[model samples]
Target chain A: MCDLVVTENGSVVGTEKGRIYVKLHDEELTTFPSESLESITLMSNSTVTTYLIKQCLTKNIPILYITQNGKYLGGYRGVTTNKTSLQRAQCELFNTEFSLNFAKKIVTSKIKNQISLLYRHKSCDDVSTDIESMNNLKKRILFCDSIDAVRGYEGRAAAVYFKGLSRLSGEFAFDCRSRRPPLDPFNSMLCFGYSILYNLFYSLIETKGLNPFFGFCHADGDGHASLASDLMEEWRPLIVDSSVLSLIRKKMILKEQFTKAEDGGVYLNKDAIKTFRAYIQNKLFQKNHTVESVEEKKSYFDFISHQVSTLIRAILQKDFSLFE
Target chain B: MCDLVVTENGSVVGTEKGRIYVKLHDEELTTFPSESLESITLMSNSTVTTYLIKQCLTKNIPILYITQNGKYLGGYRGVTTNKTSLQRAQCELFNTEFSLNFAKKIVTSKIKNQISLLYRHKSCDDVSTDIESMNNLKKRILFCDSIDAVRGYEGRAAAVYFKGLSRLSGEFAFDCRSRRPPLDPFNSMLCFGYSILYNLFYSLIETKGLNPFFGFCHADGDGHASLASDLMEEWRPLIVDSSVLSLIRKKMILKEQFTKAEDGGVYLNKDAIKTFRAYIQNKLFQKNHTVESVEEKKSYFDFISHQVSTLIRAILQKDFSLFE
Candidate 1:
């Protein structure tokens, strides 16, 4: 695990006796050794003392500063190690057979997981018709000649997938995958879960020295961890969606646990968010069977690192099949 | 993942298409396909439709019921899967050399990981004196005469170890390792994290078809997953402690996130618990270095199942070293 620190709301991380410590709100304190740390995330209102900065620079740990809402402020790192050549290859390989194959595999994997989720909550009668259409969509995406076509099929399948989600009914209904402020409780959980998921995938991508902004399916965007997105697609239903269904249906999260904004945006009450996060974490790490080759029953938790490592390996070998 | 559903605060989980659907407050609905779900957790004050119960029983899915505070409230499982022979072997093996070796190896692994964590975060000067004692304790435990002796050293070393943790000053401090309504935030986090860890390990034990109450390090206890506890020891410091330190030091958790009980107990405030759980979940599944035979940079997560599988293999082969 990387020893990364992220401080917020006027907490300053500094060094004491060669170990990292934090002084918060001018009173509270905490310390840690920086040996295993790979980076530090400094949110708005967070401060990094000069000594801590120097040690991070010397040790080559990147310090990422972002806003309270998680906008990327900037990053601090020692410049001796760079990946300019690798980034060039990432762009070059985006439209190649490698990217095409990887994207197809991930999309197919995602659809299959989505179908499986539908089958879980739906009766034989509920999903019986949709399953054939989904299976057809999977094959259509698998045979698409271009990334754009794959994206098209994916969008269509998502429409079907999201509609089927409505069948969950009661407290856990998804009416199209709404975003931004998350217009519904289910959407709020999904959005919240995905945000944590993105950060996790981004961290792994950064550690592997890959360009998170360049991905096969997702084109380059302003400060986006696009590659992380590409890697995360196959896992969305498997990890986040499954957990959402389990948590809500299992009654771990309820309707009263959410608050609606004046704009009709649904947000988890202060209490539900914790329960959501904790439950999601448990769900992610809890062991289960996956298509991935593992020693025994494996938790979806390792898939982030595992898949990212596979991406790096595939890129280095010019073999996209290695991914996923 | 298990099909078990925990219902509390008024939620009902039912079946739709061989899938479990949860209805909350009679208005909200969430569904999960029962495929891959091994069981359902039924908590108190929850209702299950007759059709759903019949489906679960017909499908042979066990429904484990617990209290809101998480006490075992019995279970609704399918016809018994007898383990007469395995239970006999487990009981006979508990006090044998097999148990002794498995217990010793786990202690050694735990000590090694602890030393690594200390060296990682400890100021060289602070740990200089403490390191020698820890090293000697390691050796002493290695050569201890009996299981009780090994337990003794583990306890003595804990005294020195807990003292060293004080070096992590500021808000991230633990006076001692406390449980059962942990008295400090750190301890509370530990207790909560361990609870989830126990469930994860217990699930694996059940899957392995081993008796959870029979174990090597921990003797049989009333209603305890003794084998899970034994398996959990090597991992507690390796996984949980490291994450606790990282999360607290990273400032991902804050001081204001806790509440003071009128009786002077510490508990995670409404918000901190979510962040704490989510962070721990991420930490548990966050990829890290571990001593396991694998293809890539493996996380300690797989070790949960890996070690259990090893335990099963060792018992079958009568070879104890397989556990480590």
Candidate 2:
């Protein structure tokens, strides 16, 4: 009845018109496809005719014989090379189902953390430029509000201003005026944070047919961390920034935990590394002490990686809103 | 004299005050520990005291048993609780051996390439500046020679000026270009070139006990392609520049092979991809077709990866000339 049937024993059978018969001996049972309806007997030298097997083979049907105990015998069938096409079709169907399920899961997850970061340095003239850049990024994410507007005078000057502002914002995050040689806590956290995110992102990318190195936003270069960088961009504020701030505020990791080396470089110690790893794992798993059940808390990291992949799939299908 | 000696039949024969004896159904043989002996056997019913076994165990010596057919069986005396020390010692020994062999192979093979590169990139303006930069780079593999040298110069401008001068002076052979958006063929080639290098570098970093993401030359930040860029810096002249120049010179790929989309974005076509892949593989294998004899050539990609790892080992040992 079916185009092809794959049995639990990992055997494939194709059927057009054929019937299989079974017989039992003293302690053993055997099955065979035969044309004639004859009763099987013990101690009888029964033989299977080649004509019946040839008939099944020519008719594009395969009948595989199996004993009662699931011992496999051979089968007769026409040559089948269309299995690859059928397999590809099946794979696509599974992928679509997986994407839809992942999307639904993300939409319903309780892992939302929204934070706005603004760079307020002594040299910068306009603080609103930072706000404006954040607004533009938010708008791209489908958050449209009057506050999310970039109010600027000149196009060329604004472009240059924004470029400078972006570079300054990055520098501000890295500069530590309090410490000698400036231990960049923000960038350090980002390095570790992105590593974790990239690992998860790569797993999701592998699930999709796309190569991780062949990316959309990042230009390919020799040793370009294309996929890692691409995925980390959208998640910077939500994950890396939030994690660093929480760690510092909670006094889980202190400034003293960072050591200044002879080469004028500062790095986190083993204790700090252990603390950070535990903190990140907790954030990723969304484990909350206040929550009644673990299921009530959902990880934002997991949601983003899975949902972004689904969003990419939906975009390919011309469903842009899925990204929002 | 040994406390105990193994018999030929894989049985333990106890030596009584340095006098050992073998018992068989047909015959028996006795010998002193100082005397040369043939294959020996132990009777199954012979009553051998357990105190001897305990004495052997306390001494940390192995009990040996010999078969009638001249086979020997050995057993340790004491139990080993911890394997970490043994493993560490074994690893140290193995690494020493591997390093020595690798250094010999590389020195013999790569000295010519290194000399040629140095000669080709020789400049006149200030030999000390270039030498100083190269010396500094030798100290630390990841570096921005031109960026550190030229004041008030930005990204591609600094790279081009440095590379151009170096090429004119016969210090380098490849042309450097600014990476532009909407990807041109040169940029595309660079992109592909870097991706290949990145994958290979990551694989090597994984083999060595180092974090690929943590780098020296590249600044730490979110989505910074530090590890990939770090590995690529050393091999840029050898692999990427050479491949791109060869592709251009041979005319295996044309400018028309790159399609400029309606959106102004350019991408290489299928034919160009094939050509690029073939070129990359050829470079990776370092196959020489002109010479009649089959000479094995190490791929520049493989050489860079090995060079970095060897450098890391050398640093651990406080050996400075690993790069040299």
Candidate 3:
């Protein structure tokens, strides 16, 4: 269940007889049995051997590629699952009445979480009106008949949520949401956190044997893992936004720790990225993150696994009530 | 379009500055530009760095894995394409009337090639009756309305073709086609060769952005690349069987170069596999193999590429007449 993060630059990672070893020059740095690994994250310039890749694929341990500056590149999701029945079920369920219900659930749950986050900062700012507006939109999503309608409600809620977030910011300058080249440090952090959450969902959804491209709420697009984008909506505010808030509110990241790129995009600097990653790891794994719908206390990792499992079971049983 | 095969036992392959380099214990073995490689085949025990893999994947160069004894164990087929329209076309055409016609064509083409190979050895043995029986089955396949019936005819033709192959074998003891634990060397060679052919088609099919699991002739089974298995049928006798026969006729492999395993399966020994691989490479790449249907003179490499292109075009166009 351990996520192995290899940040050692210029080192080679190899596997021999099922044991993974790291070496620099002619010196063996470290070795461990690969059976305990859940995922491998390469965060720096390092080399990985084919034998290790073979072992990872055999164990279904996804190898995630992330840049040293905290941007998430794509990952090798190992082999596509051989579970054709599950894949067929997923494809068949898309665009059905069942899918619309699931889409509404995702939107409502996401807005509900957004409202909760806004409520957390109630003492710091007057976010009650925005929260009320989002609550109304969340209710309206239940009556949505089409995928586009659900997305429309979700988009409206995002407008209120982002505005509410700007008011809650104690020191950071925040405005409307911007991306591609996020204008402010606040939006940059949000974009970076969202990318990480999206890729996390991507790996989990594929591991559950569902087609990531075939989604319920999101329209199908070429080269897009639409389903991952759909599923991560409910968790974005809870996992990513909360973590970003913690880092900002605790004054753990200073304003000087960000750089404006040539394209006018603000990005986290190298030292700040290290602090950000450490904080995220602590929040996702060490802290108590619970599923409010299930009323169970667990780590965020378990929470993500539960959501993926629930989606697959709902698809398998042809029922959306399980999602509710 | 060169396929790089790495056979060094303990060498490590890495890429830097767009150049691929192989090393062993700090001593550089070889270096080349990464852009020149079309595919990579790992034949012996070796380690490949992640950088090389990333480059290969970005370039769409499939990395194939083969055992020291020539068993084709899967490969890394890189990323699935972003071509949603092409994928949609493939899925929509599956199990349609078009698929039935396509399935029949695959069987007929396969049987035709099998009959051609048998004819090549006509002077070696009296295989006239087996050839005629296969010819009758081949013609009947075109009239098949269902995939099961086409497969039934294919099975009957295979019975005749394998018997014909046994009769044509000059020195190898091949009574019948035995697999799993092939009882004789000839059957073992056939099994090994077919595995390679199947994987080759698997990589090619995925490279074309088609789902390899959804197939035409073969029934979709869990975990099986049915489309690869179906498509390779047309090329099996032409590529695998003919190369195997040439190995036997030219006395390239000796009888003593085969070992009987503890499970009663006869397999090519270490040295025999090398000779067999070299001969197959020569026949596939160096020989002027002509496509009789198009009256085109090309290498077996181009022949395989042409077949894959034909199948993809047929799937995209929704017209099996193109295959004809």
Give me the candidate number with maximum TM-score: 3
Q: What is the DockQ score of candidate 3, to 2 decimals?
A: 0.40
How would the candidate models be sorted by lDDT, starting from the highest? 3, 1, 2
lDDT for each residue of candidate 1 in A222-319, tens digit (9 for 90 to 100): 34567778888877887788888778767888888888878777877756765765676676667775664556776676666677777777787787
Candidate 3 regions with alpha-carbon error over 4 angstroms: A15-33, A69-80, A287-296, B16-19, B24-32, B69-80, B287-297
* Candidate 3 docking band: acceptable
* lDDT per residue (tens digit) for residues B30-136 in model 3: 77887776677787667767666655665667777766655555565444454555665766676789889888877888899999999988998899999888888
Off by over 4 Å in 1: A1-324, B1-8, B18-20, B26-33, B36-82, B123-125, B260-264, B285-293, B296-299
Residue A214 deviation, candidate 2, in Å?
30
Q: What tens digits encode model 3's per-residue C-alpha lDDT throughout A2-65? A: 6666777778877777677778775888778867677777777677776666666656777776
Better of 2 and 3 by DockQ: 3
Per-model lDDT: 0.66, 0.41, 0.77
lDDT score for residue B96 of model 3: 85
Predicted structure with the largest DockQ when compared to the true one: 3
